[model samples]
Target chain A: MLNKVVIFGVGLIGGSFARSLRKAGAVREIVGVGRSATSMARAKELGIIDAIGVSGAAADGALPLADALHGADLVLLAAPVAQTEAILASIAPHLQAGTVVTDAGSTKSDVVASARRALGSKVAQFVPGHPIAGRETNGPDAAIDNLYVGKKVVLTALAENSETDVERVAAAWRACDAIIHRLTPEEHDKVFAAVSHLPHLLAYALVDDIARKPHADLLFQYAASGFRDFTRIAGSSPEMWRDISLANQPALLAELDAYMAQLTVLRAQLAANDGAGLEQVYSNAQHARHQWITAIEAAETPPSPDKAD
Target chain B: MLNKVVIFGVGLIGGSFARSLRKAGAVREIVGVGRSATSMARAKELGIIDAIGVSGAAADGALPLADALHGADLVLLAAPVAQTEAILASIAPHLQAGTVVTDAGSTKSDVVASARRALGSKVAQFVPGHPIAGRETNGPDAAIDNLYVGKKVVLTALAENSETDVERVAAAWRACDAIIHRLTPEEHDKVFAAVSHLPHLLAYALVDDIARKPHADLLFQYAASGFRDFTRIAGSSPEMWRDISLANQPALLAELDAYMAQLTVLRAQLAANDGAGLEQVYSNAQHARHQWITAIEAAETPPSPDKAD
Candidate 1:
């Protein structure tokens, strides 16, 4: 069991991770750290953390980090992507040798770079990780012990990271019932940029475009369940998404270009009134989507022991 | 009450309309028509219609139009976009002089054009209508009596349509508890193209793009609920959407261009690492979506009679 764990962002992800670990009996004392004292205190009251550490804007490393880091076995940086580097630097001096550091940031390459810059030689203990799980809700109140159950936790271990440190981080996630997969920071960034970040950006853009229309109220009135589902991600946390967009810019821009090319071809077909061409594109998408859904359902279904034999 | 109502297509929209009318006791007799005899027969068996008329491929007007059209007070052309004109033309030769004709086609301008071409002088009796309601599931089996209840039915009344004909169609939808709204065909097309059609096309394109990736299965495995909701429309009927994309090309292209412009600006912000700019866009979208949802909920909430007084 971990002696003590410090989570430097007591939001939904961090709080959920703490809850999961508590349930798994994987950690002893859990300390929640954040800029908001009220929220951190509330998190403590909600049993999301064993104690609360309010780290106010003292950038000189005088925020009683020693107490929080004393005998700490793990440090989870679950702050916004933009704040990861600062948090890393602040805690680098206090973390004991062999203490594993990890993060739940959406984008990885930037976070990995931040760990390298902030920790220097201590980066050997840093294993950048992202759990592909979240709800539209926020804060400690939204935390649940089972949020990471059956979820995917992607680890982009730095070249400097020791195998033991990486394994420790992976073990923590597995304790939370999350399956761990490793990839290069670049590969993780690219894959999520296409599947997650780009889709969120597109959703935000679509909703913004529609909201700006002259007849927006009328348009929205006619907007059915389809529009509701399509723009659901537009309701996500703006600050979090903003940090992610900037952090993974190159990969996101490349994916946007690829997507724009697809839209352009569709536009050409529509413009030419090419019914057959339109049918072909729509048919291909429909068939592919059906196949993907089928594959997902099949994977989700457990194989019977009889069938296995 | 209508003496006789003949509905072509007999799919989700058509079948739902027939079921709604039956539930409302608004029609004396409802005749279902379709290309598939089995489906039409099933629709009849399911009580979605009083009788089934299998319109065999004998486009030579040999499909006993007289019997189906005999004493018909109303006719609903609910076929696919491409088939609307043919269905309108086939029934035009037999529709009684005072018979009111309406449709549930998605694109109004195209359907209005079809009515004009098919009905000639009888176009005055045609009132193009589009009920803004549906489920992803299609066919008579998916029909629900309350599908149109509290839904908006947009009527793009043609220039040739008499006020009486328009009112007749409005009354029919009102009986099904649908609220009727009027718009010019051009305005209707533009609004829907922006809010509905463009989103559907983008969704399809995004899903198709990801499915073509070499690591598509991996990508999909990591895709969360957000991706599922965002790409839900990609699973829509290909033939139906193909027709809509082609039918509303000009408006759809315009909306697509506007959406592309928004995406391009966002891309520039990401490339420039303009966190503030990205935050502004995302914040605006999130706030707008929240407000829209609030407005929709408020609108859906029944007003107190005391407040009305």
Candidate 2:
């Protein structure tokens, strides 16, 4: 079991990690470090963390990061992507030699680079990872112990990371009931840019386009389940999406350009009144979508354990 | 109560309408008419229809449209948009003078025009309509009795329609507990093109792009809830969407162009690393989305029922 784990941002992802570790009895003495006192207090009251620690220096009512990280076994920089470097820089000096650091950032390559810049040689202890489990909700109260159960958590291992340290990180995730996959940091970023980042951008853009129209209220009134499901991701936090979009720019922009090309082809077909061509593109998409959904359902299904029953 | 109704397509929307009318005891002797005998037989077995009628002519052991339309109060063309002209043309000769014909096509302007071209003076008895309820699932087996409860259904009344005929159509929808809105056919087409048609096209394009890649399996495996929500519409029927895209070409094309312009702005922001600009767009979208969803929720909420409870 891990002892004395410190979490830099005790919001949804970090708070859920703390709760999961606690539920599994896999960690002892969880401490939260963040800039917000009210959020930390809520996390404390919710028992998501055992202590509230201030970030920079010692203070009257809070435990400083120096003291919090003194005996820590792990540190998770679960804050926004833009803050990765700064959080790492502050935590690196006091990090115990055996302490392992990781992150729950959506994009990996940028996080990996930030770790290298801030932690210097200590970057070996930082195993960059992303949990592919997300809801449109946020904050500590939204956290739950089983958030990662049956979900995929990706670890983009660095060459500098020792095998032992990487294994320790994997073991911690396993304790939370997450299935882990390994990929190079660049590969992880590209995959997510297509699957996650591009979809969000598309949803946000669609919503903004409709909302800016003079007849928006009338349009929204007529929108049915299809529009609701299609724009569901547009309800996600803007600041968070902004940081993700900017951090994964190259990969995301490439995916966006490809998607535009696809739309362009579709527009041409529409302009030409080519029902057959539109059907071809739609058929391909519908077929692949069906295959993917079926695969996911199969993977999520449990084995027949009660044949007798 | 209405007597002797005919439904041309015994699928999700058609079946749902038949079921709802039957459930409310608002119609007598619902008859199913379609090209697929198997589907019509299934509708007969499911009790969604009382009689199976042949569309084109008298057939072996089947009721012909000439017999089915005798003294029929209504004929609802709950079929694909592309079939509007042909169905109306086929049924026009057999249509009783008192019969009020309506449609459940997603697009309205084309359906209205098709009705006018086929029905001539009978166009006065043909009321153009669009029930804004849809599901990805189809066929007789997917029918439900309460499908339109509290959902919006738009009736685009023609100048040729008598006030009494329009009222009769409105009464039928009210019997199914659907809220009725009246819009001109042009307004209905434009509003839906922005809200429903555009989103569906966007979803299909995004899925086709990612699924055609060599690493499609890997990308699909990593797709989480956000991706699932965003592309849910991509799972819709290809033939149905193709018909919709072609039938509503003008309005949908305008929407598609405006959407592309929005995407171009987003791509430039990404290329320039403009986080603030992206955040501004995202924040505006998130705010409007929040407002729209909240308003929908409020509208859907029933009057402070159970103050005593």
Candidate 3:
């Protein structure tokens, strides 16, 4: 049975996985690695991991990629995208032949490419995955063990991904009670561009637009719950969004163009005082949102009123 | 000692006022008027008012606008903007000479104009007000007594407004726990156009943009808390938003133009793959949002753990 797991970049997602896995009693040990001592200390305090390691010691420990492949069963990559390629390359020589590796990166294709280039023989064992769960809050402190309980986790894998690797990755998420959705790396990027990346971009854009206005402070005050919801993602880490936008430029730009086009159409209609047209569009969107929300709620784990914690 | 209160349009705003006043024991024998039987029924169910009256009774029973409006101590016009002029015109001759006639319209100037034309002498008693609250959800069923608590209720009255009229209107809102921000009609519309109306238009535009995308379903699925928050306003009653946009057109259009310019700059930066420039904008927006939120929390009510029922 896969027991011990080493999670890189023990921040929000990584720490969350550790906590959930521990809560589910699905892991014997979790070794967390990160640069910040505070993160490492917090991870331990939160019981997110059984042990914490900083720098090289964690990198070269017994479950050191190759050694871990021998003993620790899974390696979860949650580091920043820019550092991912280097980490994959550094650990490539140490991976055990059949050891399965997975990632929780927001973007997929690049990670897949890095995996194939860094670990040739082990390419079949690497599955790229992203859990669609987060909050305006971040860090290990923000990690909620049940964050992914009913959330969708997309796994982007190539045809070459071994059945064993896919199952292992899927099993890991199932332990967290996450619903699994499978797709190709290309499909994953395109899909996320519209749903995730595009929304974040629009939010950032809207907030920026308002921020530059003279009465921005009052605007923010008058910013009802709707504005708050729309701009919440704007508060995300700039470094993360920077990488995401650049990595998925083509898809994001395409979405942006499409969004701008729709805006132009709506603007013109409003300029002409076309109430009918505006109402039709609003009704359609309202219907779509209602249906979407209903579906999501239906997919939720049966309500446990006491589960707020 | 004002015993009888007449509230026109027994919908969300009107219903909320009824509940608040009743709860505070500020008014007796409250009468509600709405064309829709369903809304009138809901108002009764919610205990919004003591009686439901047909248009004539609610509009003209309380006070005759000319000859020192007598019976109604307070009359609140809570109807749509397009209907505001006619409603005021119809009730003008009946308003008691001393009765304080106010409105809860989003756009103040137009309502003020209606007041001036409809009741030349009573114009001084006409206080145009808008409480910066209300949900995307609407109708009497959505009304709650606490809606105005901690909300900014802007009252726009001319310099000629009688002290008695202004004080009475101000006292009404204070009983409902609102912070009054007094401004002129023109200034109220201009400031709101920037802070409220423009944001709503942008949200609707974005929603329309997303709805038109090929992968709209997928895109919307990944819409995080931010997109939801931002677009929440877009789901408001079509009739209400139409009135707001049209009534506050000049200022809203100017704000829209400014936003479009900002969007164009961002689009150019994206097309050029200018990561640094993109990051700069994102960082600036993040900082602005942070500062804005901080200030809002400081100025407004504390973030409620349990939102208004």
Considering every candidate listed, which one attains the maximal DockQ? 2
DockQ of each: 0.77, 0.88, 0.51
TM-score for chain B of each model, two decimals: 0.93, 0.94, 0.86
**Stronger candidate by DockQ (2 vs 3):** 2
How high is each candidate's TM-score? 0.95, 0.96, 0.88
- The TM-score, computed over Cα atoms with residue i paired to residue i, of candidate 1 is 0.95
Compare the candidates by lDDT and give the number of the best one. 2
How well is each residue in B178-284 modelled by candidate 2, as lDDT tens digits?
98999999999899899988998998998899989999989998988888888889888899899888888999999999999999999999899998889988999
Candidates, ranked, lDDT? 2, 1, 3
| Model 3 chain B poorest ten-residue lDDT run | B60-69
Give the alpha carbon lDDT tens digit for every residue of B233-298 in model 3. Answer: 776776778777877777777777777777788888888889998898889888888887887677
Scored against the true structure, residue A150 in model 3 reaches a CA lDDT of 76
- In model 3, the runs with Cα more than 4 Å from the true position are A41-47, A50-72, A120-122, A141-144, A301-309, B37-70, B116-122, B136-144, B220-226, B299-309
Q: For candidate 3, give the lDDT of residue B26.
A: 87
TM-score of 3: 0.88
Docking class of 3: medium
In candidate 1, which residue ranges exceed 4 Å CA deviation? A54-63, A303-309, B54-63, B303-309
Docking class of 1: medium
Task: List residue ranges in candidate 2 displaced over 4 A.
Answer: A305-309, B305-309
